[model samples]
Target: MTDPCGECGARACEELFHGLLALDHSRAEPWGPLHGVSVSCFLLQHAGRLPADGGAAARGLLQAYLDGGLPAVQRLIGRARAANSHRVKAGAAPGGAARGTAVPVGREAPRGGFTVTIEQVAQGGTFPAAGFPERVRAWAAATLEVSGPHSA
Candidate 1:
């Protein structure tokens, strides 16, 4: 869990690393235009691993993507970066603004039509491209659907 991007809650930091790394197994960039959605969905679902601004930016981008399309998504990504909104850091600690328990996500992860960790997504597998791009869009859509209404 010491890895800043290990919020996926793998049994071990190595597991988490393998899971996230597996996304690139096909050596193709599937996120493409939906990069914001892919990232935002991942960030928002792991509420326990996100900073306040990160969550807001994620939710906002999803809303923007729905209301204003790619342009809006790009704009929010820029602003989020400026705000230092990003995957939770190791020393960020688990308290206050962070929702959900800071503990590592496990099999007990809630199924909200969205994955709680990169490992889960990887488990779906992506071979010969494995429809990674489509998976990202679908995952983003589901994340938005279960995320409830967005404000601002």
Candidate 2:
């Protein structure tokens, strides 16, 4: 059977997922090393696979990140990093394996999904605290197709 996400042709979701992975891997200069892969990315990527409530759940988490500011984003990244480490140790692909693969990343569905995390120390403290909000805003716009006041 075709994967539910593929069947639904959720290209936006897939793009967001891959984009987030690239961002996480690259440790972009402004972001100062994202702690882990975002759970938001995973949910959006597999939106079709989620239960009926998945959209709302994913939106809520994303909103929380938007509203939460730098500290909150940092905390979520921490969780993602921990989850990622666990997956790696378990011999599972860090982030959903090879797409289309049914590898569950911790929990799934309306409750929310999972992501892997990374830890690295930047020589000069994290990216400027003021810059983080803008970075996230840009990320939301570029990756999620999110625009408008909420995107910032």
Estimate every model's Cα lDDT from 0 to 1: 0.52, 0.40
TM-score of each: 0.50, 0.34
**What are the clashing pairs of model 2?**
35-118, 36-117, 81-117, 84-116
Tell me the spans in candidate 1 whose CA falls farther than 4 Å from its real position: 1-28, 32-34, 79-123, 127-130
**How would you encode candidate 1's per-residue C-alpha lDDT over 1-152 as one tens digit per residue?**
34434334433434443444555453446534555575566665555545544455567777777677778877866764555544656445333344443433332322334443444444433312465555555556666666553531
Please name the candidate that would achieve the greatest TM-score relative to the true structure: 1
How well is each residue in 1-152 modelled by candidate 2, as lDDT tens digits?
A: 32324422332444444554554566665443442314443444443443343334344445546667556766765665676775466655344333233323553422212221111111122324455445444443332442122221
Worst 10 residues of 2 by lDDT: 114-123
Q: In terms of TM-score, how similar is model 1 to the real structure? A: 0.50
Per-residue lDDT, model 1, residue 5, is 43
